[model samples]
Target chain A: MAVDTKKCVGCADCVVACQTENNVPHGFCRDWIVENVKGTYPSLDMKFQSERCNQCENAPCVRCCPTGASHIVEGGIVLVTHDDCIGCGACVEACPYDARYIHPQGYVDKCTFCIQRVDKGQNPACVDVCPTYCLHFGDLDDPNSDVSKALKNRSWYVLAPEAGTEPQLYYLR
Target chain B: MKEELMVSGKHIAEIYPVLHLWHWEISLYLFLGGLAGGILFFAAYFFIIGKEKEMSTTVKWATFIAPLALMIGLSSLLYDLHHKLYFWRLFTTVRFTSPMSWGAWTLLIIFPLSIIWVASFMKDMFPNWNWKWKYLNQFESFVIKYRLPFAWILMFLSIILAVYTGILLSAFNARPLWNVSILGPLFLVSGFSTGLATSMWLSKNDAERRILSRIDIFFILTELFLIIHLFMGFMAGTAVKLEAFRLFMGGSFTISFWIFVVLLGLIFPVTLEILELNGYHVPKWVPPLLILFGGLMFRFVMVDAGQITRFLY
Candidate 1:
């Protein structure tokens, strides 16, 4: 997604909005901002990159799950079925990004990208509520789509691509 | 770091390295491979003595149980592979130099031999089946009767498979902590000791105790010697290679290795074994528990400590 950091105030309205919408816990977060603080008192640069599940096209978590509990949907969205989960934590351990969590109910859990809402006509809770309009999701297969357009134009990187996970999330620098 | 605290990370502590979830297959393999070593020790004892009735059902049990363990173990390993269909390739091309290849071929041989050996002794023990397999059953009996020489060959091979697993882990030169010349001896020591303990538990009679306890002592001394040799090699090797020793001396596994592996697995077991040998009252079960505990703890400590040390770089 084209996250114009100059526009993000780091206010975390998206965080609160997301928790209430998805019933996410307080201490743990579906999404987070990593700030690399540099320099002494005289000089400083607070570089920020908001992070969450990459929802890979070629996901290790999906391949590792023997029961197919943690899997990829038709939209290439990484999805987990709570009922089928054996709480083996194989997916959690396999993820290089450490995106998966052992939910309180004892199953692999991660950012769904609001699969239910995105399945319908509505955008994801975080995407809809972001004050900066920084979050973007669209059909990568359709080059005309905004995400694919950004991909064509911008210099971007995916997390741990060496893993062959082919994460869908992208950062435009 | 707490003194009691050990390296407890994903293959390593204080780092994030790529790791595969240890499948049930691997776990079962470790257990089964170890069991094969234990059983083979007894098989050798039985064969050299040259009597079926002389040895307890434990020999027979160990004969049959060894393969059962291998089958379960191999199944798990088969399940863990990236390409399960190509497992036949393990045997189709046997590289004698590669321990893994040797292991696969050995499993192919060991499994059938174990069953045959057990069935040979079991033919009269178990009631004859009402259903007959035509000429095959008589041929099977004939093969079993003449299978004594092959049984010895299988025994030696099975023992090698058990110990070779340790060598397999040690072969990873990138993993310097495990890369030691003494690995083969170390594994052999533990395998023999565990085997003696296992037989001691199920077998009866003074002669069995006397012979196994002697073998047990020999193994304990040999194992201790190998551990020292492995440490000396690491210490004398380059500092980069000796990163594992630093971990051994100062890192998390210092206690687990010194205490669980050394004290409980070796010293206590050896002490009890000696007492039993000297005619002091010692339960048959005590030695097995200590020996088994030591072998398993050694694997755990070795695996965890080795991985963590590799991550330090």
Candidate 2:
């Protein structure tokens, strides 16, 4: 996933679309928006970011899960098997991004990158609903894919890169 | 120049990671697990060393407490689980890298072994008691005959159980306060100290009490050294770890960690034990009780404060 920060207007259509599409429970979210403001009032700089699970290459959550419920699937997407999760919260604490939450129904929940939709040849609800076409989702493994092309021509960075998670989410500057 | 950042569409319930997921239940479980480990270790250590007659309370009586403490601790862990019914999944497979998996398996082996160890000593504590069934009686006899070997196994398992309590927290590298390697040894020493204190309190023999107190003072000193080393290591590390160090140095957890865990728990108890060892008129119960109190507070403070220290803030 690559998010074009310059084009984001903080409208949060993606947030609503995700909630509706994923059936994410009320008072909980798998994705959200962050607005960062820098500099003084007379010379202000602001950026809005749409954030969710990083689905890191070196996901600590997967490594720390005792029950193997939080495992990596094809395409390197980290997922939780609800029935297998004991919900001990080890993965919750191990996650550097604070992306996971304990589902009210008694399991850890987090963004799956809308793998269900992606598997069906459709964009994630968040990416599809993005008004500015700021959110791009595709295989980084395929150089001609949307995410690869987005990253090819722009300066991009992942959140908490120093944590060495090798996060898959790319924010285009 | 002043700058402000605003985050919208993020609910406080979901985004706030501080003590939200794990709270008092986990802390209590850690405390009880450590205490149980301490009890079993001392019990087996003395039994294997032929101090069973002198340290009867430690070797016999305290051995019974190990299983009970562990069961209660495990119950707390179960209660804290979100998917309570799915906890059986912990045993279906083992992930070596996951400390929690190691703990579940260790408990599976140790909990039963602890019970059998207690039953083996049951006839000694109550000479008239006997198993209701012949096979049960025969099994008890076999356990008694192989008691020495059981003591060694118990000692080994107890050490793993004690160290595991700390490793469980330290394994989470995302939480800066708990990511240090020192927590393993530190928790082990603290568990032993608490175990010795419990035994000392229960022992009627002044000699046993004095011996345990002297040993406990050593454990307490070791625990203190490890704690200081932990903070110093944090201070010399990354910015996030320094912030974690500040959590006890002068941050929100300062008074709790310093006053309860350090002063009342370690320093005061050690002073009392030292005085008692030197033939001073210190009460026997004071140091042990303080040590136990401090041990509990230590876990509470560590678990609560650790959740607050994160890499991203």
Candidate 3:
């Protein structure tokens, strides 16, 4: 996934859309918005970014899960098998992004990039509902894919690059 | 230049991961598990060295407490588990890379062995107690016959169990406070010290208490060394790790970590034990009780402070 920081307005339509589509429990969210402001008041530079699970290539959640409940699925989407999860909260603590939480039903839950929709050949709900058209989702492996093209045209960065998670989510500056 | 940042829509309560996930249950479990491991290790060590008859408290009486501590510790872990009924899943698979898996499997082996270790000494502890069934009698004899091998296995497993408790927390790289390599050894030495303190407290023999107290002082010093190294490593590490070091240095956890865990828990006990060893009269119960208190407080502080010290703000 690629997010264009300049285009985002911190409106949080994507956050609501994701919660509604995923049936995320009340007061919890699979996606959120961050606003960063830099410089003095007269020359302030601000940016709004939508964030969620990075779908890390070297995901710590999968590595630390004792019961193998948290695993990576097709397209590198990290997922948790509800029944297999013992809900010991190891994955929740292991995640550098703090992207996971124990569900009220006793399992770890996180953003799967809306894999159910993606498997059906649709964009994630957050991507589809983004009003500024800033949230871009596509196959980075394909050279002509929208995500690849977006990254190719803009200088981008991932959150906590020092963490070595190899996070797939990109913010286009 | 100063910069301002604001985040919105991130209202997940579990976002405060430590507050929602690991709490007193984990800390208590870690303490009891370490205590059990320490007790079993000393028991097996003395039995293997032919000192079982001389150190009756270390080898026999303390062995009785091992299984109970483990059961309570494991019960706390079970109570903390969100999916209590599905806990058997921990045994269905083994992931060597995962510390929790290692811990689960280790406990599976140690728990039964602890009970059997106690059972093997039943005839010695009670001269006239007999098993109702003939097969039970035969099982006891078999266990006693190969008791040497059991002692060796118990010793090995106890070390692993003691160290595993610390490694479980240190394995989480996301939490900078717990990401140090020294944690495993630190916890091991601390566990052994607490184990010795317990044995010392229960022993009626003056010689046994002096020996155990001396050994405990060494373990406490080793633990202090490891703790110093842990902080030194963190201070020399990346920015996030330095922030983690600061949590115990002068941050919210300073009093708990320094005063409770260091001064009262380790220093005070060490001083008391040393005085006792030097023919100075000190209350028999004070040092050991303080050591145990310090051990418990150490786990509580580490677990609580570790949760607050994350890689990300």
Q: Docking category for candidate 3? A: medium
- The DockQ scores of all candidates, in the order shown, are 0.04, 0.72, 0.72
Superposition error at A87 for model 2 (Å): 1.2
Q: What is the lDDT of residue A161 in candidate 2?
A: 84
lDDT of 2 by residue, A1-173 (tens): 99999999999999899889888988888998988888887788999999999999999999889999999998989999999999899998898878898898999999988888989999999999898999999998999999999999999988888888889999999
Show pairs that collide, candidate 2. Answer: none
Task: Give the DockQ of candidate 3.
Answer: 0.72
Worst 10 residues of 3 chain B by lDDT: B12-21
Question: Model 2: what TM-score?
Answer: 0.98
Q: B1-313 in candidate 3: lDDT tens per residue?
A: 7978766567877674343578899999999989999999999998899998789999998888789999999999999999888899899999988999989999999999999999989889899989889998999999999999999999999999999999999899888888888899999999988888889889998878877887898999999888888888988998889889888888999999999999999999899888888889999999989999999999999998888777663
Q: Candidate 2, after superposition: displacement of residue B268 in Å?
A: 0.2
